[model samples]
Target: MDNVSQITMFFLSGLNETNNHRFTLFFLTLLCYCVTLLVNISVIVTIIMDKNLHEPMYILLCTICMNGLYGTTGFYPKFLWDLLSPVHVISYSGCLVQALVMYSFACAELSILSVMAYDRYVAICRPLEYHSVMSKQRLIMLVCFSWITPFCINASNIFLTSRLKLCSQYLGRFFCVNWIIVKLACFPAQTTVNGIVADITVVIYTFHGIFIVLSYMYLIKTCANSIENRAKFMQTCVPHLTSLLTFLLTGLFSVLIMRFGSKDFPLTFKNFVSVECFVIPPLMNPLIYGFKLTRIRNRILVVLTFKTK
Candidate 1:
């Protein structure tokens, strides 16, 4: 209780091993961050500016790119600053906010992807009724649901975490996370509610993953019988699947590390595992969509060419 009362900031130990390579890491990180911003923004701008690309599919892609920005913004700036700073610490309230941003960003991403799967399913399975099913009003509602539901869930988790009486101010990882904060609680019994909430959150997103897989399964079966649908599936569904796989694999790796990571492992390796989802997904999502989607790629090329002239 006294320890919790005295703690005002958390000391991050993740950067301790990287001091010698701070400048090198900083430049590389800055370049990655900039590229992430440029590519995602390019995709987003291309979608918004082109009236022809204003369908639900393109809008979903734009939502994903926006989410990539949201998730990375929660980490990279603070991480870049930490690379140069003498001490890596964050205020109590700041830590909670970061946890909220990061968890909500990740949760919202899966929610969006699930919504995309549903959109794809309806478009491919019932083409005649696509617009009637996925009307503008409905699209707005789905988008809002994707973002808001996750935010509310994570907010509840963070609220539960905030009530814990923490014993330690030292966070082993580079950033604040609800799980880590809960782990810092002095009494094991006090964290039961937090653990339960976390488990429920995981279950919700796991269902999201299952929904995506089931949607694709039905898609494959339907597309197999039609030449045109097969081509359409190849054109659109493949990119969404690729993005979903990349995001899921990276996210699962991070979650596994957090759950089962060993202290015996090198801090540098652990740090990399901890932050891979934040780094890789932000950089990869846009590149995957940009190169794979013909409309986006052609629009981007035209924009670049026009800008140069």
Candidate 2:
């Protein structure tokens, strides 16, 4: 195939593709995106404006909220447009930008979650030094890395892919994930595979793995220390455990799909997991925090009431 023939613009073959279904999906996703915005924004504003929530914990949550906002922004707008206009083809440049959006937010979220895990570990295991260890400078440094690491990889992948020859026109997925883009490219892929493996190793093998181990260690230490209020600390940890499980499982599958799985997996569990990365983490992080910590819930309620004022 000629270079011109090899490359073509992609349409996000929607999951629910019928005309009526498109309208329904547009409204539903619109509602979700709107609500997510209101909630995350409220939390961010509250944490910033209210002195009560100016602590490291709430600052960390603000970072988490920012990730959620960007993630959802990266995901739903195209689907919404496809619904409204029935014209779903994305340009080559658009697809490349979309991949960058995905990489940027995904990397930020993974790193932020790792930071949160460490935050909780320090709070639980080293309460005396929690403030010292997670000082404002340290927190700034952590969030700076969260934002930087993702785009660094994003730049590399986009730069390399720009030079490749594309052979497969069909990239067998609903959205524009990088691996699907690579699958359609008619280029030698050993370098791509190595890059994928290295990304996973940096995240899963190096950082996330360390966070999980430290979290479990913190849990054990907390349990030992909270002899009188064992139930309280355990109850506090229940939400974190749930959040950690959901985040890791969804993230792991996303990496797995890019690494080893076929595109057809999207017709099954993989699609659900892909959606989970955007839909679940944002909703769950706030909900878990609200449920476990009365302070955040009350703060959210105050923020909501203020909005409706």
Model 2 over residues 82-136: C-alpha lDDT tens digits? 6787556787777878777877777777777777777777777778898899999
Best lDDT among the predictions, by candidate number: 1
Q: Per-residue lDDT for 224 in model 1? A: 100
User: What's the lDDT for candidate 2?
Assistant: 0.71
Candidate 1 versus the native: TM-score? 0.97
Per-residue lDDT tens digits for candidate 1, residues 1-309, read 442435689999988999999999999999999999999999999999999999999999999899989999999999999999999999998899999999999999899999999999999999999999999999999999999999999999988887778889999888998888888888889888888888999999999999999999999999999999999999999999998898899889988887788979887787789778888887898899899999999999998898899
Ten consecutive residues with minimal summed lDDT in candidate 2? 1-10
Flag regions of model 1 displaced more than 4 Å.
1-6
Best by TM-score: 1
Residue 47: error of model 1 in Å? 1.2
